[model samples]
Target chain A: MNSTFANVVARRDLLRELTLADLRSQSQVSRLGWLWWVVDPLVMMLIYWVVVAGIFGRGERYAPYPVFILCAMLPWKHFTSSLNAASGVLRASESLIKSIAFPTMALPITQVLARFWHHLFGLLVLFATSWIAGLPLGLALVQLPLLLVFQLVLVLGLSLLVACFGALIRDLKGFLGHVMRVGFYLSPTLYGIDLVREQSANLGGWMADWLPRLFLLNPFAVLIGGYRDVFFFNRMVEPEMWALLTVQSFGALWLGYRVYLHFDRRVIKFL
Target chain B: MSDAPKIAREKNAPVIEARGLGIWFNLQSRRRVSIKSILLGSGLRSDQKVLWALRDVNFEVADGSVLGVIGPNGAGKSTLCLALSGILTPDEGDVAVRGKVSTLLSLGAGFNRDLSGRDNILVNGAYLGMRRDEIQSRMEEIVAFSELGDFIDQPVRFYSSGMRARLSFSIASSLEPEILILDEVLSVGDQAFQRKSRERMQQMMARSRAIVLVSHAMPFLRELCTHCLWLERGHVRGFGEAQEMLDAYEAELAPE
Candidate 1:
């Protein structure tokens, strides 16, 4: 037991190195350099605002639709990209995987961390836009990092699952891409949760109560919802919401971690 | 024989120990005969065995000692290297490594081919458990040692096998390890670099770090190792003081 703990701790040092290499590889192609992190999403926010908000003049009602979408989009982007990159992290680093005694989770953690750090650039833009556009800051903004912790735990677990499974089955990437495509419409990123509840409360049908409960447990749901509360609602997160998010986070983490550890030794061979 | 227990209790105990180590390749059949197909009278022979890579190998090395693992072709030297490096788990017996180790099994095992030379160094250093600053501190030393000149900025794939081997060796030896496992890497470089590598290794050994060198070069084996393990057909042909083991191993291969 003590040896296992020591091995796990020894992995952190390697994780620091992997993270730096990851960032360096990411930043090597820079005409605009690290600015691209903020710019890529800023460009997307503008494009969405133009087509969806400007053309339809929905900005009048949504007020800062950019801010709304930014909040919703930021975490969604983080979650999906983390999942997408993680799906290939082990396969991509096949050489390192085969040669070293690196902790298997290092791959997923770096994927999640890189995506999370990249999303921070977009986040700085969000906070600045919220202030400049007069969305009004609240004490809740201070708590967003704490809320993001739950989201990260949930994503970390999901990344582990995706990385291990994806290493074994090459076709899983396609299956996941299709699932994310369907999920985009189903998730509350573009539409409001109240809108879904009002119109499609029975959309879940047989699993009505059970499915939304599971769907809300999707990590990004709580994540984007919490984000919305901070920026849009300007109110503190409800105690029940925070509690449910914690449970959901732990469940994702536990399931993801177990799956990862089970297949770790064989992942490199499969790759 | 009298010193076995004393040796076991010493500081930096034989960095690697393997007793009865063996690896069997259980590759699933290429053409999978489904259960339905088999039941429908599609006859197939399911049992197949091609190679016994390593079989019932036992050996020991002392701290700060270099053990040259020399073998004939297909004698399981690489498999032994993998087992010692913890890359491949054995099916029988056990292998235990004390403290940290750096394994240079092959030139580019941990290298990222797409990344620049500098980036591969960082990745490789991390594989050896060096932090960013640690790698940073040793970066100039590694680059200078490789002597790739202006090509250090280029991708690793652009370099010849020799250059890749040099960089790998340089990064590996840069970090002082309690255990260093080398697999035929010294022979990859040009003659000048080979001499340089041997010198660097000698300096490393002077600090009392154990090195397990695997090669077919008997001269190299005679030059460095206090002990030589002669592996034949995945089992020990002889193990003792360098010259006696090497002579016995050569006589076994000399003639019928």
Candidate 2:
């Protein structure tokens, strides 16, 4: 047990350096460079704004729709992209995985860290925009660190789980892409939770009542809700919401870690 | 050895010990039978077509000794190197290494070509078990050793194959690993660079690091190796002193 702990510490050192390298290499691919990280999300927000505000005419309903979406969109983007990249990291690091003896977990972890780095930059842009829009900076911003910790644990777990199964199944990438696409609509990134609750109430039944609660059960929705609650609403997260977030984060982590460990030895062969 | 005691076996224990090591690969059939299809109750053969890359292979390497692994193409030489380094777990047996191991299994295996040579050095160094400060301190020395000069600042994709080999070897050797595993990477760069690397490897041996060198170069093996193991078709054909195994391997290759 002591040796395992020491090994994990050593692995952390390597992970830190490799994560920096991974991030650098990501931006090096294009002449536009790291600007793409900022621009890509801006473009995404623009599309979301045009579609919901222009076509659906829902933008005025939310008033400050961009900030509303940005709160959830930024975290959603981080979660999805990190998982997408991490899921293929083992296969992507084929030579390293086949030749080196370092902890395999580092590959997926570096992806999460790199994506999180990009997400933090994106968050900076969002905070500036929020200030421009006259959204007051409150003590609620302090909740960010705790929210991020929860999100990171959840992301790390999901990434490892997907990556392990991804190594064995050639079609996992395609399947994941579809799942994430459906998840985009299912998540509360574009629509407000109150909007869903109000609409579901018009349907008039327990199913309608369960719909909002069920949306909260989607961990990403809960995470987006947390970000929205802290940064936008300036409200303390509900106690039940806290319990749900903690449970989702730790539960995903436990499952992911266990799945990764089970497949660690077998993954190389499949790859 | 199955029931061997957990402790109290330190009578000149080998730095690396592999017993009954085996590994197999599944050969994907011409048409991949999807798991979904199988679960739906198709009658396709669920038993995978297996290719045994290594089977029941066993060996030992002691401290201060150079053990050479020699085999032809597809003879599991590279797999043996990987297995010893703990990259590939054995299916039937186990390999125990007493100390830190650094492997040069392929030229620039972990390098990000988009990154400059200096960054690759930092990454590869960290991966090979060196700390960040240690890599930074050794940076210039590694560059000087690789003889890449100003090219060290350029992205590695611009580097020639020989340059990549030199950089990787220089980074790996600088780590001063207790167990060094090389896989046909010593024949790197020009004859001058080869000679220089050969001298460096000899110096490593002089420092008493247990070395496992996998190569097809017989003369090189005879020159440096204290012991050798010959493998063919995933089976050990010979294991003994370096010169004897080289002689036997060469004679076995002679035409009838």
Candidate 3:
């Protein structure tokens, strides 16, 4: 038990080094350096806003849709990029995996943490945009930290699950790209929860009552809703919803870790 | 020279023990099998060929002993080193290692081409389970041993193959792990550096509880190894005293 604890501490240190190296390599390779972190999402926000708001005039219900979309877009980018990296991480570190005996899970965990550094930069941009848009920067904003933590737990869990399968299935990386694209549309990024609620009411049947509820089942839907609530609307997601999302996030983490443990040793052989 | 407590070193107590160890690899799935092929039912149509890289091999290395593994190319010597180092899981049987193991499996195995030689040392040291402060403290010694001098700060992508090998050897040897596993790494760098590395490896051998080395250098193996294991086609062809095994290996290589 004592040695296992020591091993965990050593693994944490290794994770820290790998993550720092990943972050450093990422910033060093590009001419723009870390600016790309903020700029990438900002550009993505513009493209998404132009398509969903400017062309279709769909997001007017949540006026100043750039800020609205950026809130969710920033977190969504974190999710997508982390998962994408996790899918190919084992293959990318093939030589290292073959040579060293460190915990294999560290590869995906390092990717997720390194991407979180970029997400923090995106959050700064989100705060700046929200402040300029005259969104409330009040007591409600304190909830942002908790929301970020929950999203991180949620992302880490999903990344582990994806990484385990990704090690075995060479096509998973490409397949994940398509899945994330479809997922972007499914989540309420361009639109608001209110729009979904109103549209459901317009259906005027059991469909109206159950449609929005069904959408909330997606952890991202609940998470993005929480982000919009804190940053843009200056409100709180319902406590019950917060509780449910928290449980779901941890559930994903537990399930991911379980699956990773089941396949981690076998995964190394494949790599 | 050993850093481990004196009480821990019981003379001739085995630090590494392998019992009927076997490692097998699927020939067809050695390269990653894509989900597309599996879903198309093509994967099911093929009969998998399992190649036993090591089969029913057993050995034990006691404290303060060096074990040299010698075999021709494709003979699974490197596979045994990997299994003992705890990198590759055994497909059959078991290997029990009682101490921390450090391996020089391949030159520059974990290096990031964009990072400098010095940065790679820190990264590689961490991968070997060294703490940040520990690596920092040993940074100068490791760099000096590599003898890369001014090139230490240059990105590894520009490094020559010999320079990368020297850098990796320096990092792996400097850690002073309880059990050291070396695979064809002693032939690195220029002749002068090779001699220097050999002397450094000798010092490590003195300090480490056990050392497992894979090499084609017969004279060097004869000088260093207390025991030798000769593998042929993933089977133990011979195992005994260094002189006897080396004589047998050389006699087999010479014409009748």
**Which regions of candidate 1 fall more than 4 Å away from where they truly are?**
A1-8, A54-63, A201-211, B1-15, B22-26, B29-55, B63-65, B70-75, B89-92, B108-123, B131-140, B148-164, B188-190, B206-209, B222-256
Cα lDDT, model 1, residue B70: 85
Regions more than 4 Å wrong, model 3? A1-8, B1-12, B44-47
- Enumerate residue pairs that collide in model 2: none
Model 1: lDDT of residue A26: 72
Cα lDDT tens digits for candidate 2, A1-271: 0112246566677889888998888889888888987887777878888999988998987767777888888888888898888777887888877777777787788889899888888888778767877877698888889899998999988998988877776667777888999999998888888888998899888968898998888998888888888767878888788899999999998898888887786778777
* lDDT ranking from best candidate downward: 3, 2, 1
**Which 10 consecutive residues of model 3 chain B have the lowest summed lDDT?**
B1-10
lDDT of 2 at B159: 95
What DockQ would candidate 1 receive versus the native complex? Answer: 0.27
lDDT value for candidate 3? Answer: 0.84
The model with the greatest TM-score is: 3
Across A107-173, the per-residue lDDT of candidate 3 in tens digits comes to: 8888999999999999888888888888767888888889989989999999999997888787888
Please give, for residues B160-193, the per-residue lDDT of candidate 1 as tens digits: 9889988988997886767777778455489999
- Give the TM-scores of the predictions, in the order they appear: 0.82, 0.92, 0.92
Q: What is the TM-score of chain B alone in each candidate?
A: 0.79, 0.85, 0.88
Between the candidate structures 2 and 3, which one is better when assessed by lDDT?
3
Per-residue CA lDDT of candidate 3, range B1-256, in tens? 1113222445565888777889987777667777788888775556788899899898878788889999889889988977887777677887777788878787688898888888888899888888889999999999999999999999899999999999998998887788888888567899999999889877887888888989998888888899999999899998888889999999999998
lDDT for A266 (candidate 3): 68
lDDT of 1 by residue, A39-146 (tens): 977887888799778797766556688887888778778878899999888778777655665566777888898888888888899988888889778887877887
At residue B254, candidate 3 shows an lDDT of 90
